[model samples]
Target: MSEKQEHASAYWKENLKYLIILLTIWFVVSFGCGILFREALNEIRLGGFKLGFWFAQQGSIYVFVILIFVYVRLMNKLDKKYGFDE
Candidate 1:
């Protein structure tokens, strides 16, 4: 393959690893800690809000929003690095 193709492929491979890790963390924090293990987490409270309830109702949503921005920023950097951004 050409050098450009090699660079692009490498870039994608690296980025995919980051994406997978970020998604996994997202899933665990949102689903596992929030919905599934909520009762267990209820033993802990922060500022009048239960940990699980906060995660379920607000924390997860906030994290998701942040994740979107993080993805956008990362993809922008990736695009620029790969010469895909104009």
Candidate 2:
């Protein structure tokens, strides 16, 4: 492949890697905490709310937002590194 093509491919691969990792975290927080480990997590309290309940109702959304920011920042850095940020 040409140099430009190689850079584009590498950028996409890195982007996908980050996307998969972030989504996995989302699934674990939303599904795993909300369902699979709810009972166990309920035994703990956070901000006076059950951990699992919080994760189900609020925490997951918060995490999703944070992940959005994380992705944006990472992509910006990646773009700069790949000479695509201009």
Q: Per-residue CA lDDT of candidate 1, range 2-77, in tens?
A: 9989998989897898799889889998998899999999999978999999999888888988988998899899
User: Backbone clashes per model, in order?
Assistant: 0, 0
Error of 1 at 22 (Å): 1.3
Q: Model 1: runs farther than 4 Å from truth?
A: none
Q: After superposition, how far is residue 66 of candidate 2 from its true place, in Å?
A: 0.6
Deviation of model 2 at 18, angstroms: 0.6
- Give the runs in model 2 whose Cα sits over 4 Å from its true position: none
RMSD of each: 1.9, 0.9
**CA lDDT of each prediction against the hidden true structure:** 0.90, 0.95
Candidate 2 — worst ten consecutive residues by lDDT sum? 77-86
